[model samples]
Target: MNDKKLELECLRLISDGSGIGYINGIATFVTGLLPGETGVVAVYEAKKKWQRARLQSIIKSSPERIIPPCTVFSGCGGCQLQHMTYEETLIWKQRWVEDALSRIGKLKVTVKPTIGMEHPWRYRNKARLHRESTGKLGYFKERSKTLIHFEDCLLISERMNRWIRLTEEFLTKGYPEIHTLTFRENDKGEGLLLLEGVPTKALSEEENPDLFEALSREGLRSVWGSDSEGNLVLIWGEEMFNQTILDMPFDVSPLSFLQVNSKQTDVLYAHVLAEAALTRAETVWDLYSGIGTLTLALAREAKKVTGIEENPYAVEDAIQNAAKNNAIGHVEFLKGKVESRMMKIEEQPDVVVLDPPRAGMHPEVVKRLLELKPQRIIYVSCDPGTLGRDLRLLSQGGYRVESVQPVDMFPWTQHVETVVCLNRKHS
Candidate 1:
């Protein structure tokens, strides 16, 4: 019933952080309700089979429940599991992966406990914030366009928070054209700013030399503005900045994809390398390789590693990174779609590594992988739903899932990064 207040017990959390409870054989999803907790909820939308509700009051809270450190944690869309203890979140993350594998993939496999951070807060190396008409920079409320401003965000470093405040103050003066601002940082505390809008007279370094100089002086090594036409204009400093992953230096542009949590990235990549167990005899193929981070890492032990990526800027960076790392000899980069470029590849890989996007690998890419039958396949996935779907297809194609390792790459969020290793089953 729409707008009906009812008491219900939360059974479990769904993929999107909503607690699911059954009411008369129908499912009721409520936000802010944790598992093992009973709460009164106001059902806003009711369907024949399911309903959506908002938690009104918690009759009983879970033992894992804790006060979120961030003042705007409840309203901000940046984090989902802040109310729960970090340990409980890790357990739930592992279960999420296991549930996906069992339900979606129909493959029973052991999922290791989620690898988590010692200090999860302030781990993110990137922040993309929305700017309101009033020049307030913050994230939107969960599932709403209503922007919520905060003095600080727990996920990003304090320096980044200052940068956001500075940028917001600048925008407050004038520059409604700039609607979005992205700030990226490296381990070295170097920052990069991306302003998504047309450069205005106020934004020009020639006119506002002090503003640009101030940003540069405040640890911003590079600043860029991109318009609707996808044209990037350098506002200040160098075009490329540096980031080190696993003791390897990478030239990262504002556009390149990088794992946000620098500490957990090290843990994730180290686990992938251990699972790969390369012995310098096998040829490796890194699909959907962005800037050759993993590809170059694989090259250290594999006979040869080829990276296939679509973004031209990322490919250029990967080429330069390979050269800079002295991995050029064993690593080669191909700029194209993985599904299409894989067809033209002449070398048959002994080991295949895939780090696809949230949408997962293309069907054609999965089909070709089955046809090629690489002896071992290691998949790094961000979305468990898609990972399970593709894993089912690969399982049916004569591959056996060897192991699943879930890593808490995005702390305080429902997102979990997983690394799966599968082997070709022999007849």
Candidate 2:
């Protein structure tokens, strides 16, 4: 009930970048505070066990604290750890994985140091932003619909930033139908620009010429416009571009999943591949395979790799990618949820590799994995919370954690991508 300000020394950071502090034997989490810092806290929300507070002022701060470079750092939800030095950010991520395993997973497995980028800035190859009705391109403010229009973002690649400028200019010239814009560029300089417009509103026939002419100047490999239903109805150049990973070319579409940090993706996948330890005679099952990125990689080393994905679009791209990589004979793509399609396969795989989404694998999928009892299970996870929960279940089902490697895919954000390797217990 007290909104009165009280000074507290922050002890550590929680998952969402809030610092934990103790006041009157009760823990309170305050935003924008770092460990070893004394800050004046004002409680905004109080719960039974802890309270959420706002850092009013910092009387003392950590040595790692630094002024964020981005002009919209405080308001934009795009990046969270920009306030700290890049080195400190990596440290925070490593601690997060360790804490999640201990607290959430209730496991004592050792977590390795996080693999970070040597040059972390401007690494993002994909960006999703909102186009306001006022004809502005910007990101939504933190926890709010308010738009924070930025002239430049340090996280996006140089090509994406240029496209954003051209987009703003194009809108200023009178195109306000687009509600959301998602842009992606490959290392080869080819890019995909997707415009999502109001579903019910029909596009005026007269607007095509002017808009297409203006957009063509940006030199994107493809420009796709979709109705509110998200079905592509407009195409400029091509719908897909080629991206090379580990010297293997992939057909990357705007609809397909590609890691935003291309360089770190190779690093992360290399770790995953190493952890898989394929003997060239093991059958690999890649669950939630997107465009066969990992599936194709595993196909090169495994006897046969079967990929199960729900997105038919991505499956189409994955099939194409395998042919392009000349691994078609070793890999097959199936379009369906892993939980459902996995039950259809009669043969058991020697090794299973799954790169699940943030929510982690479905419970049914985990239950099935236990029934199949693959010798090795390599889980590529983006969210540690879900990874921890899943790990606990798998461990209880007789899987022993071998090692965990955390990769810093997003440098300035609180997000951490991890690869956990587990081996089934022997009788």
Candidate 3:
């Protein structure tokens, strides 16, 4: 195939973060192009069936196209749909979820309208920045190995932005071994920092005692450092950073999994609880529970809530969260793999809530659910590809997907969070 500068119209935005077009009957997937837009593309990668191209020039732009506000919009992988309006992104996200359920899962169910954020900017509470050997600190370029250096990121909170600058300055001085720096802020207006570097090099606190003190005084609740093995060691501070979710206080560690958007998380959890429709007499099992965000919420209404998680740190945080919230009697946290624990559950739950990672639920867990036959299941998924596959298996295992609600947790990005409710039919 020869490179051609032919006019092509983009078909649709696919899950892999690209727009589809046809050139000489060969499907082309290119970034920075939207549906209904006509652009001239330069073919870069030609495969047997589909080809990847780079946009040369836009002859006709889509109505949804807008001037992105980010300085590194094209290079940074932090966002994908910055070229389109927020409303259009939400619509496209919902459609993608529906397409996965229908085309991939083979389920003919109504996918409810997407729940969007009123104000979508500067909502991210965490930033993981890559540091170059030359002391350039920023995010990695989209679909490439290049690191795009920046003084600040527009997506994270204003406070975290300044903290990022502070870390960049601190590392630029003498810490050439530090490869990546991560910062996270919570609702309490406090933040934490983690420094990760090469395996051979160790984090030396003695070298930068004054810098550590200054960072702690600058509002970092705690500072941690790590090497290639990815284990965190406390460098300074004893502040137990706590964040409130729906009026319950939960302790957040340096590296625990958290929903990046704090405000939208309130909205997302409300939908999950609503779909649960608990009667205050049900026993609920929250699988893959992270810091008891959903477990504590469910504990308020359910008779008993048992949460099983893989992270021991998160499990400890969950226990402290339950005690801190003074709602311990109704909730319990167990540390282990959820798959192995699923088989040992002698007392079946009336409801099961799964907020698994992007990979979705495990096959063994799905198999165990078929055997347990829980009355109801609420699955919150971040990746639609895995979500579709799990829903297909659950549907085959006698569960029916009742409602699908898409939440725009990370606005201006291609990622979307979905909360699905499934009910089992009487056999």
lDDT of 1 by residue, 1-427 (tens): 5577789999999888789998788899987789999999988888899988889999999998999899988788679899999999999999999999999999889999999888989999998889888899988787789899999898999999888887888888887788888899999998999888755434667877777777777788877887777667777778778999999999986778888888888898898989899999999999999998899989999999999999887898999999999997889999999999999998899999999999999999999999899999999999999999999999999999999999999988999999999999999
Model 2 residue 286 CA deviation (Å) reads 0.2
| Alpha-carbon runs more than 4 Å astray in model 1 | 199-202
Evaluate residue 114 in candidate 3 and report its C-alpha lDDT on the 0 to 100 scale. Answer: 81
Q: What's the TM-score of every candidate structure? A: 0.97, 0.95, 0.95
Steric clash pairs (candidate 2): none
| lDDT agreement of model 1 with the native | 0.90
Candidate 2 global lDDT: 0.86
Say which prediction, candidate 1 or candidate 3, comes out ahead on lDDT.
1
In candidate 2, what are the lDDT values of residues 266-319, reduced to their tens digit?
Answer: 998899899999989999999999999889888889999999999877998999
* Residue pairs with backbone overlap in model 1: none
- Please, what are the lDDT tens digits per residue for candidate 3 over residues 370-404? 89898999999998889999999999999999999
lDDT of 3 at 405: 94
Instruction: TM-score for candidate 1, please give it.
Output: 0.97
